[model samples]
Target: MMASNIELEQFYSREVEFPSPLLASHIKTAEREVHTLLAGMRSILRKNIDPSIEELIVQTGSSYEGLKVKGKMELDFMIVLFHPKFIFIPVTSDYSGYCKIKFQQEQLQSEMQSSKKWTSSSPPHSFQYDFTSDGYLIPSEIYKWFQSLADKAVNQNKSKFVRKFVGNLPARTLILNISPGVDICVDLVPAICIDRDLYVVAKPLKTSPDPHLWRLSLSVFEKKILSQHQSSCHLKALKILKYLREHDTRLEETSQFASGICSYHLKTASLHQLAQRPDTPEGLLEHLHQLMDFLIECMQRRELNHFFIGNPSSLAEKAKVPSNITHGERCLNLFDDKFVKESTLNQARERLVKIKGSLPAIIQQHSGPVAYSCNIY
Candidate 1:
């Protein structure tokens, strides 16, 4: 008979809580097996140093790195120490994709930092939500785009997508993965307390080697970090850029009635022909431009109506717009050397235009359709 998954999960949980001497022996055995797989790579870990921080350290096994290596090497290992107060939030899961979860998390963290009672006393909390969130579905159309790029990978480009993201410690960082097995559960997860301090608990889970993990990691980290700093603007631009790159001028019609073919003559074409053609690059660009324009205009108008004075730089410098913009006030720029400049506004405008130009010929080939797509974004 085989042990059920639930039974195995329960068994693992008990090893944390009860830790019988017999179970301890089993843990050692598991650690030995894991170490064998590592082949004596120097282990890096974080240890609790204060209420809010875990210190980082690296340790080598009973061996040196420079010697001529031949056979595989193995050494003992241990799970990183964990504090118990924080909830263990898994940032990746087996069932759904990771792109949305990572985006949501970055958005949530940004919001938290902007709140009135922000503090550095607690460990940061992270989580991976189920796939039903609105953010998750927005990017599904791009999955096909990623797949095409993956197929193009050659020996010269294998490491192009991999990068080290953490500032203080060297560790692999990526935001997307398909596997449920990788230990994405944060080590020492943090929880907030009444005194505004934080508590951390549980180490991250270890994962088996899987190509999906690598792919997902690249997608999530890159997407999330870019979205965070660029304030959703860059992501919108990038999406349009990537779309044009993938589809080119080929019309492969999907099964939606609201859709129609790109760059084909309408009067003499059959409904099937119209539906089967690729969507227009011009239409896509127009859609995206409208969105970016709207956002920029709102921000600009808010600034102008508030003070009705100064330049763009001053408005950008303010922590918050004055009561006039929100309360009652042509938008005006309160100028400052650091904040307002003609170049900045031009850059924003140019970004919109540049994204519009980069689409496939099916879009750019026509004027009206390109306008539609740019506006949609």
Candidate 2:
């Protein structure tokens, strides 16, 4: 799961030709058309049911980690559904979005093949909420219509129709096999919005054995392993942790205490000579352990990263220990005094589980502290 700098470069090197704005605009118009159709369907269904059922809230689901099934990949659904859940395809706006998205998929597939480009991109079924201006679903009184849609599908015993009209139940995830030959899995589940409606959303559903841990863990681990080399990656880890501490203040300060210390450890470790003990498994393990401890500290402080670390200088000073300096030794006695503070406005993001009732199953405690640390020196 580690991406080398070369691999990362290759991943982004390809010419990703998105459709022109005119083409996308037409598609946007078509999307609005589809939304209109969906709204119409919900409206009709509402007329058939009693008038007392209340409003529906629609939201989409996103994948934070990769999903795997039978050792293959799949597409994650950016779910669009109504709130105040119903059985099966509980969300109301899904009925129309489903059909329209399916249609877009087929069209995109045809276009891709016609151009002779063997790309891994899925058909156009996946879309963000920005496709149409003023097009995002609102919390509206459309429950009666959704109930009627469910009833119609069930009364006829039409599973395909039910699956299509009612759609899949709200799920915590929609796994897509964008890598060819893998089947796609869509989840129909209710969504939980975190923070304001702007950024960092999570959907917690019943998941598999593997948890898609955040990419930040890998960064932390890599910085630790490369502690023997003088690399900017070490400073990168420290800055990231510092930014997280400065902007996020929703968790305990002790949670990020380790992260701050690990940043200092990485800074000191990276200053050492590379291949000081060359080609030895024992040396590698030492480096690996160093990295693990750093990552462990970050995980422990994962929740704290959501809150600001008060007395940043005090925490930094406490964490500022030298790598080779033994316990009880004064490490920074000879170094020039430097105070690292926010150079620009902080742009830190909040990382929290977006489950309705509790934190995500992929909580901090269960993440692997033993991942291979890339030598990004």
When summed lDDT is taken over every stretch of 10 residues in candidate 2, the lowest stretch is: 94-103
> Which portions of model 2 show Cα errors greater than 4 Å?
1-44, 48-181, 191-294, 300-377
Cα RMSD, each candidate: 25.1, 22.5
Candidate 2 yields a Cα-based lDDT of 0.25
lDDT of 1: 0.25
Total clashing pairs for each candidate: 51, 28
lDDT by residue (tens digit), candidate 2, 93-198: 2111111011111243465457543445743221211121122221111222333443453444422111222232222222222223322333322222221221
- Each model's TM-score, in the order given? 0.21, 0.24
lDDT of 1 by residue, 246-357 (tens): 2322333231111211111111111111122323343323434543344345334422121111212222223232232223322222221223344444443344344344
